[model samples]
Target: MNDFTFLLPTKFVFGRGVTDRVGAELAAAGYRHALVIYGQGSVIRTGTLDRVLATLDAEGIEHTELGGVRPNPEVGLVREGVALARECGADLVLAVGGGSVIDTAKAVAVGVPYEGDVWDLFAKRAKIVAEGKLPVTCVLTIPAAGSESSASCVISNDELKLKRGLSSELHRPVVAFMDPELAFTLPAYQIAAGVTDMIAHIMERYFSSVGPVPVTDNIACGIIHALVEEAPRALADPRDYDAQANIMWASTLAHNDIAGVGRNAVAGGRAGGWECHGLEHELSAHHTGITHGAGLAVVFPAWMRYVWRSAPERFLSFGRSVFGIEPVDAEADGVDVTPEEAVADAVTATIDELQAFFVSMGMPRTLGELGVTADDIPALLETLEQNKGAVFGDLQPLTMDDARAIYESCL
Candidate 1:
């Protein structure tokens, strides 16, 4: 294993009706006023909003409400949230929806204390230098993105057709309430998309070009196996609290820097290659209608197909560990098949199995199926190049031409 540091300070309260403690927790933490951020009418319609409001009222905590945070989240809404948080003098920013809402709240938390434009932080024009930020917390209603306990937050700019993410310890939530029951009412498609996103999170770290960090690899593989085992059960019955709990916790563990701790540094300084995420972000950023996880479902396997040749051993390990696909014997089941050929076959089968899993979850298998075409490639590439330079990924640094080829292969 490589040298690494792990510091996760988020106080996670998980179980049924754990959200009921949000008010008392905030009050005990001495947060006098909070800005409650949420997405559409789901929170309100499901009565989650009312429950939260009543809790706050009981604890005598003042709060301001900000709704309409869209999926993939927008910089405009984040700015508006920051403004409202400042106007209300909110000491805490409480997100009451999924990843989008939590990410927005994190952005707002950072923006509320900084004097410059919030976009400057994400665009790399400025840094978060404040010693203190508005404390952010969440009541997770969706189990994707793992933003509730992660340092990273992704926000989109509609005008720029760009989605960008920034990671800073300041953005990590101070508290996160996870109640699987909250996700029981989620649609099957959303659950599947969340599952795919969480799996991609682990895969991104697992495919790192770093040394053989057996511990990290095993943990990543175990998380993938657990998700593979539990996602279907949760999808079949959203009320299956055990399955939902497993997936929910796996989502958090996948992206909380735990899986990629020792694997962040490779010889090329590429760290955990997020090539697929870089590509998928552009797709979602430009299209706006494409779900983040659904786009990932389409892009990740295509990315694997395009780049697996660069790191066959890593791919083979993934095949054997995550998918439980053992390599064929060199001479047993076939006529003069080399060990290399056997490994290659195993890797191909693993990728095919992953694609099939995504399909079984009702995810599109191609960019075309996700509503992207050859004509969209130029625009997508332009966005990617403009936002993230010419190349992406650490496992195999992908240049513009490489990205084009990956998109073409997907088509």
Candidate 2:
């Protein structure tokens, strides 16, 4: 295991009716003014927005709101949020929706104190200081992206045709109210895509080249197993509280840097990076209409197909642990195969089964389903190169050619 430090400062108020605690938490923290941010109209439609606002009013906390945060959140709205928060003299950033909303709130929170444009942070031209960012809180209506507790925020710039992410410990929310019931009204497609995104978050850490960090590996696999098992239940019955609750908690744990600790080589630890996410970001960046999680569902299997050879043992272990695939199952009687070949067979079956799961959840396996054609591959690669550079991912250190091959395989 690589050396690591795990710090999760997000205080999660989870379970039924936890949404009511949003105001109390804010009051206790001495936040008098909030800049509420939400996506489209789901929260309002569900009366969740009214409930949250009522709580704030009961506590006498002043507030202003910015609505219309869409999936693959845009930076323009974030700039508006920063401006509105500044205009309202807001002291806290409160997001009342899912990942995209929370991500936008985080961007706005950091942007409020910075003099430069917020995209500059995503562009790596400016660094986020923990003390410089306003406190952020959440009323999570979705169980994916884990932005509530994660130090990461992803924002898209439509004009630049770029989708970029910025990570800082400061980006983590101060508090998150997770009531599974809040997600009951979500469409089946959003639920499936959310599950896929949460699972991919774990996989990004699980596939690292770190080590025999069996404890962390076990944690990652357990979350993946829980997500895989519970996602279907939630999809079948969105009102299934247990299933939704499991998925909701799993999403928070997946990206809070707990399962990822000692896996990523931050501060010169080891070899492992977010390879699939890097590739998927370009896909979503090019086609803004594509959902981030759906794009990931299309990209992850192809990435596994391309890079499993680079870390056969990791894939084999992942298959065995996450999918319960046995090496013996890959062996044929009277067929003397090399160990590498045996592992490869098991890994291939594992990847195929995973892709099958995505399909079963109504996810598109090909880029064409996402409206991405072979003609778009060049632009995708160019943006990928611009964002990720000539090489990325410590697992394999992928090049433009490798990325092109992965995109082609998705086709």
Candidate 3:
């Protein structure tokens, strides 16, 4: 256990019909004008848009519509939303899709206050002012990426061909209304990608530290278990509300640090590296063919293989406790079998399983197969280096060489 402090001020209204509360909550929160951000018309087809707008109409909140936010959100779109907010006199920024929507709103919120280009935020040149970024909330349709309640947003630039994040306590949403029913409208590939991305959040946090936090470890393990179990169920029937609810809660809990709390927790402090995200971001930036989550499935386990030796015990714990993988490798190595081997094998198997899951759900499996090439790796590496530090949060303290090697290895 380590010294830690938890801060989650946003009200989470969960469950099937819980989103109906958003209209009254927005009024209570003093949001009069809103920028309703969403992707294409999927929300409209699902009737979610009508229900949400009706709620807002009842509450008398005026809003401007900003749609067409792409996956891996763009900085230009953020700017567009900022302009919309300014023009509409919108006090609230309402994100109505999945991770991309929420993240885009976050970028717009932060960018509105900064006089310079929003790219500065990605470059680590801007300090977030809590009051600066437009106040934002979400009607979450996807359970992946945990962006709804977090202060993290991944944004992209077309000229740079780069995707990076802007995070601050100031970026956290004021409230998040989750409706599992909306998720039913998502395609199978989208569902798979969301699940993979959500689990990566936990894996990154779980593998960072070398110390002990039994409770936190258990909670991380529990989230993984929930994901592994519910993923198949949800894919089989998108209408499985219980399965959807479990995964929805797991995704939120994983990133919110609700589980990883202890006196000596490794914390996302600076150790939890998002190498998987870097790889996936580059892939998504270059080719719209691969979803962020599928790329993560390929890259994350490879990362584990590269770095597992740093803290084998952590692997062992993850394997035995989380996935029930047996340590067969160490025994074959002429040493006493260890949980580390089991963990590593478990991760490899799970990543492969996830990739296969993607293929089954109509997604690409490999970098080369997706039309991503060795040529693209160089540009992707360039985009990844835009971070202030080598790695996203230092789980492995990525360097240019290390990042290059990871991309090359993924090939």
Candidate 4:
């Protein structure tokens, strides 16, 4: 266990019909005008946009709309949104779609009040102080990324082929409305991808290089188990409210820093390394069409295999606790094996099971499956090496050579 302070101020309005109260929630929060941001035609086609607009109209709240926030939301669109917010004199930024939409809204919220370009914030050239940012809120239509309740926003720049993330308490949503019913129409692929993203968030925290924090570990394992169990059910039957609700809430809890609290070093570093996410960011940044979750699926297991030897005990613990894989007894399989061999076997089985689960969910198991080739590896490694410097990960420091090995293994 470690010393920590936690604060989750996002007003989470969950359950059925909670989205209809978005207007009232904003009104009570003193936001009179909102710049509503959304993605392509789905919200409009489903009448979700109309419903939200009607609620705003009933509440006499004025608004402006910014549509067309794509999968890997671009910096140009975020700039346009900030301009629209300023033009409309919007007091709040409300996102009505998925993570991309919400992230765009958060960027706009910060950009609206800042004099400099918003890219500076993502580029780490400027700090996002709380004094100037507008409040952000969301009506989540997708359960991935957990951007609805998170303090982070990721934005991409197409010209540079870069995807960067910025984290600040100012980016956290003031309120989030989650209606699992809204997710019923998602395609099977998106559902699976979303669940994978949520699971990755927990795994990133679960594999931290910190002292034993039993409570946090238990919570992380429980969340992963819940998602692993419920995701397939939701995919098989999108209208399965129980499964949908469990996944939806788990997504929020995974990234809201709740599962990570008290597990980090007291000196302030994440227990688990985000090396996989750092690597996957390069993939998605170069190939904007690649799904974030799919890229993660391809990279995470490979990263695990490359690093597990450095922290075999941790992997053994994860295997036994999360996957229920019992360690092999010495000489149990008609072969004499040391205790170390037994632990390694359990860890290998757990990683295999994880990769199998990703495959079962229709995720790509290799970079080749994701359209990456031998030629692409160099550029990807360059991007990662530049951004991450010489090494990545805390559980086991991964230098450029280690990263190259991981990418090669993924291929």
Question: What lDDT tens digits, residue by residue, belong to model 1 across residues 1-411?
Answer: 666667789999999998888899889999889899999999999999899988999999999999999999999999999889888888889999999999999999988878888999899998986555788999999998999888889999998888999988777899999998999999999999999999999888888888678888888889988888998899899899999999999989988978777887733122487889999999999888899999999889989988888899889888888888978886677667888888788888999999899889888888888789999999989989987798777899999999999888887
State which candidate, 1 or 2, has the greater TM-score: 1
Ten contiguous residues minimizing lDDT sum, candidate 3: 263-272
Note the residue pairs that clash in candidate 1. none
TM-score of each model, in listed order: 0.97, 0.97, 0.89, 0.97
Error of 3 at 306 (Å): 1.5
In candidate 2, what are the lDDT values of residues 1-411, reduced to their tens digit? Answer: 777767789998999999987887799899999999999998998999999999999999998989999988999999999889888999999999999999999999999888999899999999887665789999999888999999899999999989898878788998999999998898889988988998898888888877668888899899988888998998899999999999899989888877877776774332257889999998888788888889999999999999888888889899999898856533565577776677778999999989999889989999989889899999989888889999988778899999999999998
Overall local distance difference test of candidate 3: 0.75
Every model: Cα RMSD to truth: 1.6, 1.7, 3.2, 1.3
User: For every model in order, what is the number of clashing pairs?
Assistant: 0, 0, 9, 3
Q: In candidate 1, where is summed lDDT lowest over 10 consecutive residues? A: 264-273
Model 3 TM-score relative to the real fold: 0.89
Candidate 2, residue 106: how far the Cα is off, in Å: 0.3
**Residue pairs with backbone overlap in model 3:** 1-263, 1-264, 2-263, 2-264, 2-265, 3-263, 109-133, 109-134, 316-339
Could you tell which candidate, 2 or 4, scores higher by lDDT? 2
Q: How close is candidate 4 to the true structure, as a TM-score?
A: 0.97
* Candidate 4 minimal-lDDT segment of 10 residues: 264-273
Q: Give the number of colliding residue pairs in candidate 4.
A: 3
